[model samples]
Target: MQRFGWLFLTSVGAGATIWCTHFVAMLAYKAGVPVTLDPVLTIISLIVAIGGTGIGFAVATWRQNRLCSIIGGVLVGAAISAMHFTGMAAYRVDGIIEWRWPYVIASLLCAATFSGAAFAALGTATLGRYRIPVGTALLVIAIATLHFVAMTALRITPLRLSTAPLDSTQMHALGLATALVGLVVIATGVFAALIDRWTRSDAMQRLHYMAMNDALTDLPNRAGFQSELARQLGVARATHTRLGFVAIDLDRFKEINDVHGHKAGDDVLTALAHRMRSEMGRHDVVARPGGDEFVAITRFDDRVQLVAFVTRIEAALKAPLSVGPFATSVGASIGIAVYPDDADNAETLANNADLAMYRAKSEGSPAPCYYDAPLDELIRDRRELANDLRRAIDENRLEVHYQVQASIATNEVTGYEALLRWTHPERGSISPSVFIPIAEENGLILPLGEWVMRRACTDAVGWENDLKVAVNVSPVQLAHADLPRLFHQIMLDTGLPPRRLEIELTETAIMADRDHALHVLRQIKALGVGVALDDFGTGYSSLETLRAFPFDKIKLDRLFVSELEGSPETIAIIRAVLALGKSLSIPVLAEGIETGVQLAVLRREGCDEAQGFLLGYPHAVSAAGPSAFIDGPHIEPLPDADDISNAA
Candidate 1:
């Protein structure tokens, strides 16, 4: 709106000046003066008027110097004079008429009046400082001088008795006076406009600073920081220089605010800003992005220079601060990201820096760390997997590959654990370790998990009556809104008995939201679906949580199973867990068994069931149940320490 107002004022002023100048010239020609050179004079007047008006308008629009307006006025007046003089010279009257003194005097007076008026108008429009009274006085004097000069130039041929003799001395005196007055008028108008423009420009500049700068520390604020960051990034990219941005979050700043009050906090922030400014180079930018958050952007020759710069800032921040009467110290954990390295743009760089800063804060380190490819790759891979998992839902690429669980006493398959697998088109056979967390992070587990549940149920319905299929559910999936509805749909779609479908959840999955998890588990249990606690020994191993949710079985983590024979402590812990599960009427299943000795120990400890490579390696869904590996002399158990030492 302000810009439009400036344009409107300039265009109207220019048009008005051009029209008025032409109208006055026409009027002059109509007033009995020879207009032989009127066309050429008018053309000159039009150019001068348009050019002066354009210059004045431009100066006003830019809010530049008043000298521009003054110069414009002077040019306009000079142009008018030159045009009038040229027109007078071009006069060619083919008659016996006398060159009257009155006619010459009138022409000069008219020229002076027109020139002075135009100059004064331009000056007043452009200059904000000078008063109108002084300008008017100058204009009057300029008009009087022009009239006198014109009269002096006149000569009467064939002088009548009424015509007094032309006095050269008087005429010369009059002409000199007119020239002096005209010069004074133009000079005054120009000078006044220049002074006015200077004063207003200074005032505006001060206002602009106040608006852009922070009040407390007089540093740039968040908005200003964004603008500066963009500008600096552009410069760095153009110059092929390294641009570094560091996001600094003051450690324990909240404590200071809580103890000393907000006023003291403000004082500390101001002092800190001063210190930061002292530490920064002239080309660097430092800004307070938010409460207790400061950001710095600097150009460096390379990564090493950027690291050194960050180190210096970290060192400076470690120094003690004196806020009011209290001497306090605070440390800052800074996250450093370089342009065209960590990110290609401003917002991405800032976001990545913030991520790195949080990582630093979590690690409890004051030292700066550069953004590494591994971290970016980890995030990128997770995002890609999340997207792929979503597509897998539509394409039916997600499947539950079965691993047989066997009973040692009967040497028969009790059930099969349904492990989820994804075969990506480009990157084939993605591991559960990689995509499972991704699924949880992106909430893709809800739909993918539902599909797993439905597929497992359908597979189980086709299998022998005794074999059950256990499908693992992520914590996010368990917390889903339609969990019970999904279970019911799966049972109906597969025409599988509810007892044949078992849902497995980790300790973290159940403990994440105990009430919600328990409620969902109870709903499934009510439908006659068995619920197993997967990886029970790891995560939140609370007896209260176990008692809250009525789990049908507890699958011990592979970590505990792997060390059971080597560590008596691990064996004892597993025994206790197994005893607890039995007491609670929950069957304990040992996982990752690899040899007869481990299997024998689990059996001796009275474990109910086991699943591992020793029993059967995980197989495709189309494969038959657990393979039979009889306990014979040819199939020797893994050697113990004594046997190995004796052999050596």
Candidate 2:
């Protein structure tokens, strides 16, 4: 409706211009007879011109096609002819008049031809910026030709005596009134055009702002930050100054999001963004690229200055911020890269900073880490290893080794835990710890875990004894794959009974998403597959996890077992976990039993099962057959329970 108003204004202005031109030309005529206009007819003609042209312009605007433009142009020409003829009818002259049919036909034809051409040119994109001017020029030619030719088509002979018409003063007064109205109409059209342009400009600016800013924080988003960084870099280059790029990651932010609702998480992020902005210098820019990650660009003179700035930001971020009903604190792992010192370009500098950030996170460094060239090499090496692992999985070069889990009292092998072992033809054997994290990070764990499960099931099905096979599932795998369905399918494919298969997952995996993990575990349990909480007492909310899931077994982490010799605290935690498991009717399995003393202590503590090198080392399926344990490591006999307690 508003856009149509502009068109209407334009039509009124154009119509008034045409009407005024005709009347002024009449007033300029040098005929000897006196003449005056019919006021009623003049007003009616003005109405016809405005209404007709308005419809024409509206039709043209509604569709930008050649046919519509031509039709619109015809309407406009017809309106002009109507207004001219109607105004001429009001011309009260004492004369005899005659029309030239050929000249009249030629005038009408001229009006239609030029007006159609004008509109058609306006619709042509090839006309470029000259379309409007060209269109206006042709329209003027059409109007002028129509008026002059129509006048030439008429012949008037003056009477010997003139009838009384309006005096010169009255005629001049009427001309002045018409001129005033035409000026008012033109002014109205100009006002509408100006308003429309201003409104459109304001809307465009708003859209640009939305594109460049984060809606929640009203801060510059990644794109906006990059643009600002580029501009700042240009300034720094001109002035020969150094710029620092700091990449900040909120530690355990995913835990926060998973534990609390996303709304609370959003609140936490919003608070952090505000606090970060407040901590920055006026010339510095801070942006939240996505998902608990933020970045800042600041100018610094030296490393010390940059470090001080980063420290301030870290302190500010670590401070408690309010979120909804309560306040929560979050830690930041910041990585810094200096311009010209680290890298010359933006992309390289940003990558260096991100590499450093991951290093800080991995090292658990409280202070910010600066980019070092070695970090880049390490990342490259990891990426190459990831590619190799992908190829290894594809080629079936990976192998599964099994370590026996046995009853504490009888020393009878009850089950075996499947451990993945990778040996690169060139790199020899690779530890699970070294490549497991890489697998998790690079999303290779899903397929790798499936392979291990299927292979373990196939190997276990061929075992002489009906022993269970346990496989470790990473947190990434638990979160992504449909474990129950996969387990069922793998068991069917390998012809292994569900009751003889078990999945060992860490508390950290359950803590990542307790409800979802529990739901999946229940479904797996319904299929008769066992689920054990592996690496117990190492993650947050251990007691809560035990209470939530009805685990078939609890595997005490190797860390606790390793620290049992001198750490009374380790003994107390182990005792408590064992007691809790016993009370819940869930058997406790202690892993990492390298020494006879560790086995004796766990046996004294009433641990149900144990697995480590002391009992049997992990070996390939062929080496780990039923009779393979005949040559296992020798174990020292346990002392009296009271003596063991006294020694501890």
Candidate 3:
């Protein structure tokens, strides 16, 4: 319907221009006779002109069929000729006016031929380069040829005054007015066409923007990022220069979004984009390729200069972003890859940078690191481990090995720390440290965590002395809103008492979103489950964490225990941590007591419980319940000087 309306308007405008042109040409006639127009005939001629032009425009715009264009153009030409002839009939002369047969036929033929050519040009692409110019010339020639031939067709036999005709000034004024009307009609049509074209172009540009950019940050999206990177890579290859690519991931972004809501997340992204742009040079490109992930491309002089540039940009992005009522802290983990150094192509460069970035994040490295070939093995190993881990979960091949946690005072097994162990079909024993993080990153943690919790609880159902089973909870698990519900559901399903389940996390995990983690922890505790802070005193503000949150146990980090005998500062910090836990009524467990000296020191220092190879190594906890612990925990006698070599 709308298209028809445009066609109608176009036809009317064209018709008006042609009608005015014919009227103006008629005014130029000097028949030497008093002639006045017949109003009815003149009005009929305009109606024919408008109708004819409407048919022509309808055929041209609706289809590209050549035959249709020719037919429509012929009808338009016929209507135009009818109007011309009809207007001549309206020219009532007081004297006889003779019409020349040849001139009349020529004028009629010229109108049809020129009009058909113009319409044919509109219909087909065959005219090639000459289409526009030739079509335009034909139009001018048509008007000129028709008007002059028609004038010659009219001959005045005598001069006589009739109805005073129109005075010379009035005739000239009418001619000027008709010419002005023709110009106005043409101008209006062109203006409308320009506006329509602009509107469509602008809409297309908007769609292109939507396709190429991230809506949240208004930065180039993944497609745009990859395209621009490839383009830059071409330039670098051509010039034999180096290109630096950084894959950056904003840390704790999920926690921010989960704790503060999506609006805060968007605010952080926008601020980060602005910071990136501000810190980058004109040749640099920054893009938000995905959620909480940003990539940058820049030219570099060398590896050192690339590192320096990345460090500066990373530093700028570390500034706090204001999100509504409070300011949120966010930091980035960057992985750098250089062309001709780390990779030969854009895809490899991007992948290597991403791998490096994840490594920095997973290892908790403070500085951005360059891509190294040795790191590729670690990545491949993790990937293979992840695939195996998935199969381990599916094939019921996942096993739980319990490390005995003993009472230092009684020297008896108190409870067991259930550790996940995957003995891959090909790789044998794959460490939890390697596979667990990979699971978290690949989103296998949810199912893996559920299976571990359920299996551990199921395994501990009927233990001999009712020993508790402690399970480590990742920050990923804590971030889940359904974590508490899932835990209780698992408890119900396994029929294992909630009190027997101990969920351990670190100070850093709780600090991710202290209020949320605290809430989740308190809810778990409300269900009679124990919440312990694992790897305590290893992260920032261990004292503050202990003071602020309710914790049933504090597991001293293994590193501090290994360093205890060699470093006095370590012993001092250990004593301080023990003192803090004792004052708060929280039992402190020393981990990694490989040597008897370390165990004896932990005992002397009033540590409540301890676990390591010295006291007990991780052993497969049988589903046969209490017999697993009844078999007795591993124990080490006081180490002799000779035993120091095997302590680690």
Candidate 4:
């Protein structure tokens, strides 16, 4: 019903424009003596105008489709021409009013041409309501073209009549009346156009507001934060000022939300946003990028001032938030990266700040962490290493260095563990920890893992001793559904015994996707390949995970082995893990045994196997070294930078 109402209104508007255009042109016609309109005929012409317009509106908008509009437009042009000619016939003079036949034809053509243009303008969908002004103007042109051209077709001759035609004064009065009504119609069109424009502009403003703001907290969102950060960064760079890019995350916010409902979570976020804003200066920017995450751009004169500001914010955030009837307490972890000190651009600054925040969260400290230069260096070096690793993998520059694993009781090399070794032409030696994560994240782990597996199988086939080759598989690789199939294909192609090719995984990897990991591990076990749970005792629910999977070997994480000498608690944990492995009938291997002391402890603890620097450094399969395993080995642990040379 509302749709029809709008259609009716549109039809009336269109009819008014046409009627006014024709009448005004009629008023402009001066026959020099006297002229009047036939009242009945004039009324008939007005009805024709309204009726024709209604027909056009009904058909064009009936389907609201392009084809329908075009077809309706043609019919509308014919209706407009018919109405113009009907109005022309109503014009009265002292005698019969004649029209020049050629001029009449031209007038009809003009009416159809302009009326079709007007219909096409209105029907156009791409000309959004924003084009109302231009559309109205086009309609005006259409009406004017039809009316004036038809008026030009009139040819009147002076003649006396006993019925006394309307005088000059009466004619002028009619003209004035027509002009008044015409002005009103045009005015209405202009007013409607302006209203449409304002409406569209208002709607656009609302969309922009929604885009830049968080709906829940009414604070600036991530997009808004990036915009503000860039602006501030520009200002700081121009003025030589150091701007602090602080990334803040509400700690344990999930726990609070889980305890309460989501509505309470919204209330807490709003409260936190208000608190953050309250602590900001006019120039500072505070925004929420995501759930319980906030970023602020602040100015500081020096590092000390920045530290003081962070302290003030940390203290402010410690206060409990009153949400509904409950007071919810939440702490904040903050990371600060100084512009012109840590990074000059917005993205780098935001990333550095986020890294610092994670570092602070990991430390479990109350204090905020500031991004230091060494962290930046570490990240830069890691990025460079990742690039080099990609190239190394592509060019077959990566070497499969084999390290010896020996029985704890016999002190004889039982087998060799295949390790990926990269000696960059520029950086010399890059550790697996440094580049393996890079490989995982960049999706290079798949091909790299495959290469290592194939190389291990190929190398083991050529070994003088019928020893097994243990290869470490990344969590990324373990997640692949086709890993077992790929492993089977490698063994089939290399002709290496599946039992001799052991695939090692950390507990983190298995637990990452339990169902898929279990499925893949079972598939590998079905192929008669050895499955070792590497870094067993470190991850969560270690014992539970151990009982879940049928692992052939359990390699203890190096952390426990490193602390074995100094900490009794560490010794006790290792003993417990060893005992658990023994009870489960899964052989336990102690990794990172650097000295005879650690080996002696493991031997007494009933460790089945051990491997570390004390066993031998990882070397090329063809290289002759003590990698086969040596007994009674003793040496102090090397520093981390140099330890990568020997430590597996």
| Top-scoring candidate (lDDT) | 2
Candidate 3, 36-107: lDDT as tens digits = 677788777777778878887777666668888787777677767877887778777668888899999999
lDDT of 2 by residue, 323-424 (tens): 878777999888888898998988888888988887888789998988888765697578679999999999999999888888898877888899999998
Candidate 4 or 1, higher lDDT? 4
lDDT (10s digit) by residue, model 4, range 1-648: 756655665666676667767777666666665566676777677678777877877887788677666556656666677778777677666765677778767766665656566666676768888446655565566566666666676666677645555576756766775676567667767766776688689999999889999988788998888888888888887888899989998898888788898888888888878887888787887888888898888886777877766766776678988888888788988888888888878888888998788667767767888887676456556656777888898899988887788887776677889889888998798788878878875678999999999989998887655778999998899898899899999999999989888988888888888889999899989999999988877767466677778899989999999988767788888989898888999999988888767777777778999889987777786575433332333333334533332222
Q: What C-alpha lDDT values do all the predictions have?
A: 0.70, 0.85, 0.81, 0.78
Q: What TM-score does structure 2 among the candidates reach?
A: 0.64
Per-residue alpha-carbon lDDT of candidate 1 for residues 181-298, written as tens digits (9 for 90 to 100): 3454455445545655876898899887776678898889888888899999999989999899999999988888989999988988898888888888878988887788889999
Clashing pairs in 2: none
User: Lowest summed-lDDT stretch of 10 residues in model 2?
Assistant: 626-635
Assess the local accuracy of residue 618 in candidate 1 as a C-alpha lDDT between 0 and 100.
65
Which residue pairs come into collision in candidate 3? 464-626
The whole-model C-alpha lDDT of candidate 3 against the native structure comes to 0.81
Top candidate on TM-score is: 2
For model 3, the stretches where C-alpha displacement exceeds 4 angstroms are 1-204, 251-265, 278-283, 300-331, 359-367, 375-380, 383-397, 400-419, 437-444, 455-481, 491-522, 525-648
Worst 10 residues of 4 by lDDT: 639-648
True-structure lDDT of candidate 2: 0.85
Off by over 4 Å in 1: 1-232, 237-242, 245-335, 340-369, 373-395, 424-428, 479-482, 538-540, 564-574, 622-648
The Cα RMSD of model 4 versus the native structure comes to 8.8
| Candidate 4 C-alpha error for residue 257, in Å | 8.4
RMSD of each: 14.7, 8.0, 11.5, 8.8
The weakest ten consecutive residues by lDDT in model 1 span 626-635
